[model samples]
Target: MTDEAFKREVKTLYVAEAEDGIRLDRWFRRRWPHLSNIQVQKMARSGQIRVDGARIKPEGRLTAGAAVRVPPIPDAVVRAPGEHQALSPADVAFAKSLVIYEDDLVIALNKPWGLAVQGGTKTTRHVDRLLSAWGEGMERPRLVHRLDRDTSGVLLLGKGPEAAKRLAGAFARRQAKKTYWALVIGLPKPTAGQIDLPLKKTGINDFEIMRPADAKEHGAEPAETAYALISHAGQRASWLALRPFTGRTHQLRAHMKAIGHPILGDTKYGDAVSAELSGPLKLQLHARRIELDHPSGGKLIVEAPLSPEMRAGFQHFGFEEAEADADPFAGVRRMR
Candidate 1:
């Protein structure tokens, strides 16, 4: 073939099981490490790269079985095979140790508190970067959902493109159920009830916070949470179980605050009195359980135990951790 023809040749690739649910730019990066972000964005914007014959955004997600048309680039632009950065042994081991459950399609990690799920401004270390260490000889895992940096919980990763698509869909469609445990400064007046509050974000960038709003408020979205008192320490504080029906940023924390019992140690939502009573001041929320339909079939349930800080607080309040094992929403009617 002529040099000009070779340089203009187009190639088509099928999204493999492992590459599912990855961002379009990331997919290209994995295949062409030398492709700069600007090149990828330009390609996406100019329609040089198409997925299933449709122009897509760089942030668009890929699913298994999709066909991607990749325009040819000069060989000089490709990186040498060995030029990619290597994963450190320590990062790999730490990533592997967080795996509480793993299968062919997915992996669940008991993510510890203070661990960011994805990178951000001023945030260098995160689970998404560590996932690279686990991707050796396999497809890099993709995050389906996220937990707060200060919240410890069962975080799920899709092993491949197909699993990632299914898992992400489950969360988007509310097919997944999550249970959280928190130590609140004061007991909720009703003990067990639903908080059907609309929420709107306030502030800019990293300073953003979700607050209760009227239904007609601009950018307001409906959010509901079911909370039940599991135990209390003489009305001064209480251990509560929370189930969020709507996935809003900071739904649990904001809802708890709306009900006049912000979670203990939640400095963002709690008042000075609440913070003083929260003991060590570590955020007391823990994502204790998650249930969802498995990508392969049937049901999947994963649980994460409380962090040492929360566990100590639970013990001090005379709350039994085993009590959380029972259904927190058993008697309460679900309000969608």
Candidate 2:
């Protein structure tokens, strides 16, 4: 575009609390996806993109309340509130098939194992795309958070932008509580204890993994998980309940590995710990339950049934789901 056009079309936006800490390029892609990565990088390099009135890199992390100057882009297609993509009837039906719970403001899915929450490189079918089929004239479905592709259960979505913003804020503020269930190779030493460890990312993109790190290490982020032993199969395997205080990339998986009790079927972090186990192995981590204040009113609590693989594993280990406590983290104190 010409400089005059760029000058006329340029805009400034403030980062919301829910958008805090995301990469600057990600913020642009979320809002103006037609602005390609190449375009964004060039714009940033040329000082056409600035944060708080100063030039910033595309990969720079954004802070809450920071103002960003966005340059006009060719072929930019920004959607206004209530606008959404159209989906086929088959997609709509597929989206409805996963619904475990929903209300006027929220929709919760019992996301199956191996299904991705968002689309990525070569990821055509995902919860985000399916959401477009969640019917029309509903102010566009929005995901409040994410679950790993291999992880199953309790994937939450908002019916509209307002609801999404509120739900995302609750998560960012640590007000949303999530409980996970995992079948591990062996029992935790104390039976129940907190996995207090700092973590940092290693590798990149699809190959990325989290690793325990010193608190003083650069790029290290605090990660804590309060775990409780629910059931055990002697020294062979154990069913554990996990409550993560801080959400980091692969935090639960890395922490479990750091403690020498990796979740079963997690080949990436488990290091073939389940190699000797009989029968087929699948990632044994499940987001069993979640609790948070509803966008409308009152508390919103939902629980997902165990996945098919988890059921089979439970049967194999003779672990009954009912044996788990009503509130698995009831005795675990909340981290300040």
Candidate 3:
């Protein structure tokens, strides 16, 4: 990739403007005033700038409005031999836009509504795979936890082995805290209460593995939870802040279904009460906040704002004027 040592510049260059033939780097200098020639020089040294799929010297002159392709600037990624197979720089850039917070060890992203974390037999191009390509040279960051493909926001990834193990332990021991912002049909009657339901994942049903609340008296792991009413009354749907003390597979989804209110877009869990479901939303679940101990020392608290879609839905329900980061449960901590 460093073929442009001497000619450190671009090859297949195109500029759409009507400027005269100016030195390539000089033209770039004027265009991107923030970048210095030295920075441009470094880019040329990397053989990243191409004229027409060819590397050119930095001094090469450019025709006006010519298309110039600059090799993407590398972030703090660990480059590998060929670990980047199907992914492109554009894909990586898009994924980075989803990030809400990041440190050396982890990244918090706003996952869109319809993507999976890990692929099944037929599923491909998951967020996990995309992120795997990001930490390329590094240990290829893996999901420390998972959010339903349809759920959005505050998703976390462990940058390396130590961080990964520490994060996993935090979750297992309930040291990590996850708070979800959800839109459910009808207000929870009590307004605020805990649902200490036991959740299990058995082949229980082909439709879904979630155990029903009526039959929830079987042998299963005890699931503790706390929730508060964000706002409820006239709106057919109510906004809730959900905190699941234990991370169980589909724990929130199943538990919500077990109670009277299933999430808006949960077809699997809402089948029986599907009639209660209304509105254009499919799954109104958002991973609003995640707090965990950083691998290095200090604590980390990452919060994701509501997605555009969810925000619009909230506006439709006349609750668009909600509080931002209104954590009534703020300052709460768990001992590891």
Candidate 4:
């Protein structure tokens, strides 16, 4: 009868004429913006979401009158639109503390490590929830881009729908330049070069990870990263500047590992040296900077200071922060 009731039980409904020929994933997104593309695909794969009593691909088109089956959605994913989660005074202060830059068009945050950009299964505490303290409805800020839970960096948010659309366009058009700094377990052989590799998602159950894939591999997508060796503390570890030309899940981590130099503190893809070098430090990856066309005018360049752990790693590795170029992507061309 109601949306909440639907979340508690499976429902089969016929698609209306207005929704005919729409992609299954898009249909879900129009109804539930909280369900990520990956989440919807996972549901379809597990048969939690079905069409005509059979599992269908996320991209599959739906015909009018088709019976679409939607299983019970998690309460986290079924919140009404524009509803802000109630926040305590402490939560409001915590959200404000992360803000580094803000304007009429956008808000830039120095997202700390171990904080998720959005909510998901078992992810109750995250930036999205924190943002609830800012505002609600059309005036509320919206996420423009995302950073990994363990990666600290410059994260951007839009002031409203129009601003969000413009900011998102920069990323979709590949016009946004992102730079990262990482302490890798071992030195890359070439010292500096572009990693031109394809990657595909692979994992077990709820856990998913990206792995290097052949160009011809099914579902594989092209991924590229240009890196320069800033310095190294012997063969045990190296500090490097990384620029990714394409965005993919775990692109930087997978690229570094593919080259036999996994990032330090990366438990998923790291080597023995990574574990040894990490010790008490977190994943040695930081989104150092981002440059893109601002929603209102000229280029906007923002840089996030290193996390405390990253600074410690620099000291331990005998790497000078001053050695990192302010504009690491200068004169770099996008790899084909």
Each model's TM-score? 0.78, 0.82, 0.68, 0.78
Model 1, span 1-336: residue lDDT tens = 443553476755455433446689987875555678898999999999999799999999987546688898544354444322455798789989999999999999999989987654445578877887664323678677778889998898888657876787777666678889999987778898899999888986467798999999986878888988888999799999998877777889999998889988887888988978986858999988888999999999999877887887887788887666456876555575
lDDT tens digits, residue span 1-336, model 3: 332231243222234222224477865664344456787887776676766456767888764333466654332144333333556788778888888877788877888878886544334567856874464434467566677777888877777656765665566556777889887777787977778877656663234465744334553655666777787646467888888876666778888777788777676676545435544666778888887788787788888888876776677666653553557567543321
Instruction: Name the runs in model 4 displaced over 4 angstroms.
Output: 1-85, 204-206
Quote the lDDT for 285 in model 4. Answer: 95
- Report the error of model 3 at residue 153, Å: 1.0
Q: List the residue pairs that clash in candidate 4.
A: none
lDDT of 3 at 10: 26
Over 246-332, each residue of candidate 2 has an lDDT whose tens digit, in order, gives 777788889998999988888788765565663486888999999999998899999999999788779889999889887878756
Q: What is the lDDT of residue 241 in candidate 1?
A: 90
Once model 1 is optimally superposed onto the true structure by TM-score, how far is the C-alpha of residue 144 displaced, in angstroms?
A: 0.5
C-alpha-based local distance difference test score of model 4? 0.79
Top TM-score hit: 2
What value of lDDT does candidate 2 attain over all alpha carbons?
0.79
Residues 82-118, candidate 4: write the lDDT tens digits: 3434677998899999988899998989988899876
Q: lDDT (CA) for every model shown?
A: 0.79, 0.79, 0.65, 0.79
* Clashes per candidate, residues 3 or more apart or on different chains: 4, 0, 25, 0
- Model 3's lDDT to the true fold? 0.65
